[model samples]
Target: MQTNQTYDLLTQVQRIASGDESAFASLFYQFGPRLHSYLTGITKSETAEEELVQNTFIRLAASFPVDRNSKSFRLDLPGGQQ
Candidate 1:
């Protein structure tokens, strides 16, 4: 069950890499709130959190690739790899 979910997620990533805006939006919706919370916790600034979250998604979209090995896929941060 858990593995199936992971597989589905990887498929979504591939779709995103293929220029699927809806897939990317889904990714944003799924991860955005948690990411925002994490950024807010670290910086303790709402504005910074908003900026960082936006930056994160932009970077993610730019870095996306169809053939990427999903098992190793991760979001990188401007502050550094995270």
Candidate 2:
């Protein structure tokens, strides 16, 4: 990932760790449509794509990053589209 993109993600992750729901919403709004489109292209099935996106985000939330080092989950999903 680019430095700028990584910084933005870390910013959001930090906010999320601090109990910022708006930051998480910002993440979803910024990435959700693009994820749906990408998943749809790969899966070629609306139902499957939707399910995959939902599952992916669910898994992402379950692995929240706690700090910049060590505890981070190294989220590179879709090459840092968010």
How many clashing residue pairs appear in each of the predictions shown? Answer: 0, 0
TM-score of 1: 0.74
lDDT of each: 0.74, 0.70
The per-residue C-alpha lDDT of model 1 at residue 52 equals 84
Q: In TM-score terms, which candidate is top?
A: 1
User: Against the hidden reference, what TM-scores do the models get?
Assistant: 0.74, 0.67
Clashes of 2: 0
Tens-digit lDDT string for candidate 1 (1-82): 4999899899998787766667777888888889988787699988888788888887777786645444433444333334
Write one digit per residue (lDDT tens) for candidate 2, span 6-78. Answer: 9999999788776566776778778889999988769989888877876777676667746444334433334
Prediction 2 global C-alpha lDDT: 0.70
Q: Which ten residues in a row have the lowest lDDT in candidate 2?
A: 73-82
